[model samples]
Target chain A: MRNLSSRLSRWLISGPPLLYLLIFFAAPTLIMVFAAFRIPGDYGGLLPLLQTDDAGKTEVLINAGNWHDFITFENFGRFFEDSIYAELFLKSFWYAGITTLICIVLAYPLAWLIARSNKKTRDLLVLLVILPFWSNFLIRVYAWMIILGPQSYFSVALNHLLALVGIEPVSLLFSQFAVIIGLVYVHLPFMVLPLYANLEKHDMALLDAAQDLGANAWQRFWRITWPLSLPGVWAGTALVFIPALGMFAIPDLLGGTNSIMIGNLIKQQFLDSRDWPFGSVLSIMLTLSVLLMAAIAGWAGRSKKERA
Target chain B: MALLEIRDVVKTFGDFTAVNHVSLSVEAGEFFTLLGPSGCGKTTLLRMLAGFEQPNAGQILLDGKDMSQVPPEKRPVHTVFQSYALFPHMTVAQNIAFPLQMAGVAKADIPARVDEVLEDVRLQQFAKRLPHELSGGQRQRVAIARALVNRPRLLLLDEPLSALDAKLREEMQLELINLQKEVGITFVYVTHDQGEALALSHRIAVMNKGEVAQLDAPETIYSYPKNRFVADFIGQCNLLDAKVAEVGGSRMKLEIPGVGLCEALPVEGAQVGQSGTLTLRPEKIRLAAAVTHDADEVHFKGKVHDCLYLGDVTIYIVELENGTLVETMLPNSAPGRARFFDDNDAVELAWRFDAGHFLLG
Candidate 1:
């Protein structure tokens, strides 16, 4: 009897949080799946269709055609056949890849400097890096829009400078370059923070020991410092790459209508077109891409551990 | 000519001085140790010699060259840190071969040199293991091999055996002594352990605060310390406050309160009525059943307070008449013959006139 009460108490303690997740998160996802196949009625809610037996007795009915009627492959077939969608997907991948590379190159020296600097200087630099996040992310991205807009302060200044060299004013606003720049600026802190956290804990004596053994500056860094800090590099790469892939606001505001990424397509399907089924399919595909990237990262980590 | 010379070297961190105006010259192929307690600046002085730290006001000459401006990496000297500072990512052989590889030595020569150093340090079989995989003694050997592989003119060790257990520390001390003998390189070792310093070093420089208290051979430093600090630091010594009563040829009569006048060696420039301390080693004071010898000048009657029976010797803590405690070591013989002195047993303490040295301060 006592054992039963203990088991009941344990169940009661854990039941509320699990039930909350199931109702608020899991239930909505399940309902979305069900609603994707439901037949449309006069209103948005699905209504039951009636059927009569051979005796002609009236009875409440459930229609199986609600699940089977929408057999048209129009959405999936269109997404695959259209070259625009394919191009957008490929462009998103390349943009995220380039942003990740730039973040790695830039954040490495920044993180190293922060890790090796004196305490007061390091704290000040870290504060400056994170100060942008104090305001709303959307507001920060919008600030970039003002800087790159035509006839804006930067554009006017650059145009005057170029006119002196007998050149035309460069159009940088609403371009893919603007979107890439916005992504790099917004995600740089994410890359630097993790890299600094890992690099700060490195044993600096290892470098000194290497130098004592006749290793010059370059040899010491390549053979000792870099290999010891590989984990931080991998962590920084993942932190920058994953979020840049799904970035929506920066591309929309900076790239304007020309830069339509996968995130923009998903947003348009759900809100603009009101096609929840296709939106759900696209959402699932984006999630799968993230999962695949995570799996590859995990594999790389495992191999590194094995080699060590 | 000396292999290393540090002339009037002083290091200051802001207003606080770490190494004062100190000067010393070390001969080639000599094992010299800097012996001091923590914060005494022995390590700081060693670092200056290694070119890791530059003195604020001094000059360091290495092999007749002024090396005060040279950096640690460009210098021909290496240091073995107390932590071993072994590269965690490199194997034992690779760790030792790093210096040679950095010098752009031939790839074929690197392996053989590594093997030679490993064999010299008796760690040839564990060449492929990482530092963390080896025992503390083995890791220490690897660190030594790594430093010696570079063929440096001078090797500096900063309390290298401080991180080991007692047994391992002893074994490593002997090994280090032998290694120094074999290599014939100038060794500047830093440690706080007096026994380690005495055993391994040809000469020792005892440091106090930011200055060298005394620098001499091991026996001279132990037998004839220059001051109260050296006398108290080197070994257990009884320091009695006294004043000079009379001065003779090489001896002086000191009048100690609560104890009668005693004869002690007259230190240089000591005069009558000068305040000083009479320093006597514990082993130098003899305990007997009665005053058997007429030549014994300073004698005291005391009662034994405690007795400890060690394997080879027994120590008796005798409480003198003036309520001061004195310890005397007696060798153990066949059972009761050596056990005559016990707690509360009365005994007489006496020493020769030359056993006690007078310290001015």
Candidate 2:
């Protein structure tokens, strides 16, 4: 009786969260997945395949034929054959990969500086990294537009400087490079926070011991600091890459017509072409790819811990 | 020439002085200890020798070369840190081979060298295990082996055995002594535990507030401390305020207010009527039922205030007439356990004339 009561109490504590997830997240996800398989009606709704007659009235109902049609891979086939989805997928991955690499290159030294700084300077740097989040993200993207635009202060000053050097004025706004810069700027904090957390917890005495054991600065970093900080690097890379993969606003605001990423393609399928089934298929594929990335990262972290 | 010469080294952290004008010379194969309490700057001095922290005012010469401009990696010294700072990602053998690999030894010879070090520390069976997988004592052994593998001329150990339990600490202290003898390398050891310093070191420099209070062998430090701090720090000592009644060469008679006259070996700067402290070790005093008149021994009459039986020794707190307390330790060498004197028992204590050391400062 006591054991049963204890188990009952434990379930009581955990029951609400489980029910909330089922209602809010799992239910909606199930509906979207079911919709992905079904045939679309005239206005992006599921087709009613059942009919009923009661008294003198006839009513539409779910049909078994619609369920059979829903199970077929026709929408998936149309998505792959009609659209340049493979190219978009590769380009999205390429952009995200480059952005993640750049974030790491920039974030590592920044995190190290903050981690090794005195109390006041460390707090200031950390605050600077987080301060961008207080402002609206869309506004921040617009600010980048002004800074990179042709008639802006930066372009004006650069054109003047170029005239002195006998070079032509250049355009930087509405390019792939601009999108990358926007992505790196917005997602930099995500990479810096995790890396700083890991680096801050490191014992400085280890470095001294390594140096005392005849490792110079370069060897000390490669042998001791780099290997030890790998978990942080991997974590930061994942944090930046996952969001950068399907980012829409940055590419829409800064990228030109040639720079349409996978996210814009998905958005257009749903809103522009009203192809709900194709959009759902694309969404499912992206979700699966993200899950794969997470699984790989988890495996890498686990093996590293086991080896340690 | 000494293997290591520290000449008037001074280290200041901002406004506070950590090591102030410290100077010493360590012989090539001597196990010299810098013994003091925490914040006394012994570790700071050791760090200066290791070239981790530079002294602002002086130079550290290793093998007659000034090490002020040298980085830690360039210096021929290794340190066993207090935390045992073993690389968590590396196995025992890999950690031991780190120094050798950095020194550019041939890759083929690294394994054999690591094996030799593992054998020396008796961790050969567990060389493949990571640092976290080993016990505390095992980790400490790996740390020692890692340093010794370098075969540096000087090894600096900063309170290496402090993390171990009492029994393990005692065991490791003896092991370290033996290891030092076998390797025949100068070890600049730093610790706050006076007993550990006395047991393991060939010479101890007892530091007090960034200054060396006394530097001598363990026996001399115990029997003849140079000042009140050295006397009080090393072991349990009873210090009585006294005025020098008469001084003749090295011996002097002191008039202690509560205990009356006591004979002590006054330091060289002792003068007549000079106010000083007389230090008497607890174990040197003997207790008896009645006063046994001996020409060489000074006797005192007191009543026992407390008696503590600690298996191998019994400590008695004896109170003099003016309520001054004196502690006397009697070893329990007898086969059977018995209490010698109970509370409030009248007793007489006696010690040799030369047993007390009179500190002028």
TM-score of each: 0.85, 0.92
Instruction: Please list the residue runs of candidate 1 whose C-alpha ends up more than 4 Å from where it truly belongs after superposition.
Output: A1-87, A116-127, A216-220, A256-258, A273-285, A294-308, B243-258, B261-275, B294-298, B305-315, B322-324, B331-344
Q: Please, what are the lDDT tens digits per residue for candidate 2 over residues B1-361?
A: 9999989889999998999888989999999999999999999998888888889998889999999998999888999999999999899999999999989999999999999989888899999999999999999999999999979999999999999999999999999999999989899999999999999999999998998889999999999888889999999999878898998865678887877887776568678888988889999898978868687788889999998888889999999877889989888887775688899999999999888888774
C-alpha local distance difference test of each model: 0.84, 0.89
Model 1 agreement with the true structure over A205-276: per-residue lDDT tens digits: 777777766777888789987888887888888888878887777788888687868888878766776666
Best by DockQ: 2
Q: In model 1, what are the clashing residue pairs, if there are any?
A: none
State residue A306's C-alpha deviation in candidate 2, in Å: 7.2
CA RMSD per model (angstroms): 4.6, 2.9
- Residue A159, candidate 1: C-alpha displacement in angstroms: 2.5
Candidate 1 local lDDT, B1-361, one digit each (tens): 8999889999998888999999999999999999999999998998788776789998899998999777777888888988999988789998998888887889999999999999989999998898999999999999999999878999989899999999999999999999999988889999999999999999999999889999999998998999999989988888878888898686778888777788887777777889988888888888877966565468888889999888777888888777877778777776756576878988898888888788985
User: What is the RMSD of candidate 1?
Assistant: 4.6
**How high a TM-score does candidate 2 get?**
0.92
